[model samples]
Target: MQFRPTLWPTLITIPALVVLVMFGWWQVQRLQWKTELIQELEIRGAGPAIPLLVDARISAEDLMFRRVTVTGHYMHEAEMHLLNRVRDGIPGINVFTPLVRANGGGALLVNRGWVPIDWPGTSIEDHDVEPVIVEVTGVVRIPDPPGWLTPGNEPEKNAWYFIDLAGMSAAAGVLPFTDYYVFATGEKNLAGEPVPWLAPDPNEWRVDLPNNHLTYAITWFSLAGVLFIIYVIYHTRRRGPDDG
Candidate 1:
């Protein structure tokens, strides 16, 4: 048998194989990175809630997914409503209120959790309670920048599609707000009205990071292998009596 691949097929196959293998390798790298990130988050999230200080020197990466406590009063008048949240098949919105910290710890945004979109009353006055100092415990979250598909926030209307820390702070007139926000854990009422606050388990991290990179890597590698096999079969030929 003689193995003589056509020039054009060889040229095309080599480059295609290289590209597929590179893609596979890239996905493998991503898989490792994502695994490490998930592990780190789980470790940090499992620890007891730490007291969050206004002047704490903790890096943003260190604070992510970690539970923390803060003493403050909710500035309900400046509440920002995150649109398009759903709970139990009911379309709703997540209410994010600025918490003015006690003893001058600066303000922190707290996601107070969801309320139905058609919940009666529109004004903040309808939801706010009498100003009272309180302590809030929840997980720290660093909001990602709004993607191209995200709708622009309407500060004038107090409607938000995504968390915009600086923009929300400025609009609410809360100076020097914390860069990260807390997803308040536990159910609570809005001035005697029912609101289903998210109560995530304090002992375990809710891992939502998708990890399909390994699957993707395997797919790419398999495709590369199939292509190589096909190329080989195409080029190989049985020798005949006329052959020298």
Candidate 2:
């Protein structure tokens, strides 16, 4: 029971096979990159806190997971509430307030951390620090934009689902802020922690980040192997009338 595969079908498969292999290779590269990033986060997050120089030319990559101290006063008037955030099985939103640097620099957006969803019933000022001059020790974090499947931010409505510092700052008139935001690892001031709020800890977030690139790479390679087997079998199992 032999059937012949035409030359055209075999030729077409050549490019198709190459593309599949290329995809597998790309995923393999991503696996290595993700592994190194995960390792760096664990190592840096455990180190002692350092003074953050907002005026310095530090790249976000250099600042990831590193603990730093920020001295500034909260700008309660321009706070942004990041919706769709939850902690410890409780639903709530995280508060992001702009900070005016004490050392005579531009403002920075500090993720002071989460609070109850009903916070609007009261006022963000209620969580504000008493002394204008306050010190916050936290981990440096680069905010991730809304995911592809996530809804887009509505800047005009002041409703946000994820962190987009540039848009949020500009809309609230808090521009010229830091490119990266700080995840408050400790209490923002002497006022103590906010009620029903959980501070953003990098260690907890790191544990949940997915690292399945290696698995995806193997899947692509396996598909390529299956395709190759079909191609070889089709060409081998062929007979002509002369064989009859």
Candidate 3:
């Protein structure tokens, strides 16, 4: 007929406290990261495209949709057709080619853009445009494999889209290229492939991490209040009338 504070509350309350604290901490970290990203974008978003090999390094995580300049040759044999890609609302393959940099010691994988899947079951002939080096300007982007979910990159099947930089480098025999790739920004190359490079427009960037821990904290504190009220009412009702 009476409620007691015992091991059950300890077990449940302790774990809940731990989880609430950890969740709040994680949200704080996310809020901080989002703030820093916004500030950085404000300062650097207006700059011209950066060279892939520039002294100022940019990580793929941060550079997606950012404009960048790169120079390299198309490794046509290594062109991979990423399944289920689309352009202008048509299903297609996303073509990825290795760019042997003009700087002469490294290569960078470049996304040539999407092409219709009408060429299904047929391998497109490889063509060399120019042995001479040329520059490409485009936005930096993360790999978007064709499927909403893709199996792993299969070099043997020649299927790919998600840029697993390490895996791609190894499979393409690029033995030591940088760990990221760029989307070529322009008309198709001389080989008649489409080259669509997008810039980091404001409409393209999204920053949507909110801190609701304060609200959550209030909810939790309210629970604590309800528990206290229930405890007080139960003891008052159970106490003998004359007991002091």
Candidate 4:
């Protein structure tokens, strides 16, 4: 008496398995696209900074990744450190300071840059630079709400996981500002090359994070394989001599 393979379970699952495989392949394609885009932006987008004048024509925060300059006073008294941010694999916090426009229209949140973890300064009063009218060139970046898996921001403790524009504006008490932030450029690595610093790169296929579509594709395909194996083994055992 022996058991054998049947068609019923395969019939039920083949369609589903095919769909999963297709999804996995789609993710792989997306990985290639994302890799190319990230490289392109980092290469071609790197350029000299644009100095934004007091009467500069702003897009009400519509622009992104475009290099621009904002010359103003650093309101260090209202600054806040973006908690748990990192740079070039170094543990540090992003310095968020409100750059009050010299012409007096309003202010914009400026990510001054990252300082070493050992650098002193936990409060807004611990400014590394003197308060003076200055010009800064940076890339425009839009604020994003914290991801679902990300922990919520703690405004009371002055710890932030993401840039909540409204919350920052209210907390800092500077207003009429645009709904965008600027990440100052001219930050060089030890090799003396410009780094994007805090650019809004959506789909970087980082090896450490590994959230690319290829990884997703592999997962779905692997699941399909497991499902097929299970269906075969279970149906084989279910078939008896009489059924055969």
For each candidate, the alpha-carbon lDDT, in order, equals 0.79, 0.74, 0.60, 0.67
- Judged by TM-score relative to the true structure, which candidate is superior, 1 or 2? 1
Q: Best candidate per lDDT, number? A: 1
Question: Can you give the TM-score per candidate against the true fold?
Answer: 0.82, 0.79, 0.62, 0.66
Ranking by lDDT: 1, 2, 4, 3
Q: Mind sharing the TM-score for model 3?
A: 0.62
Once superposed on the true structure, which residue ranges of model 4 sit more than 4 Å away at CA?
1-7, 51-63, 85-92, 102-105, 116-123, 126-131, 147-157, 186-211, 229-244
Q: Pick out the ten consecutive residues of candidate 4 with the lowest summed lDDT.
A: 201-210
lDDT of 4 by residue, 1-244 (tens): 2446578776888898898888878888888887876665454336556665445576634355667767666677777778776767867777787878766758888877667656655455455455465666777776666788887778788887888888888888867457678777633233333322332321221212234676787898899899888876776654456773
Per-candidate total of colliding backbone pairs: 0, 0, 1, 2
Tell me, what's the RMSD of every candidate?
Answer: 4.2, 4.0, 6.2, 7.4
lDDT of 1: 0.79
For model 3, state the Cα shift of residue 91 in Å: 2.6
**Model 1 worst lDDT window (10 residues):** 196-205
Clashes by residue pair, model 4: 24-217, 27-213
Residue-level error in angstroms, candidate 3, position 128: 5.0
Candidate 3 backbone overlaps, count: 1
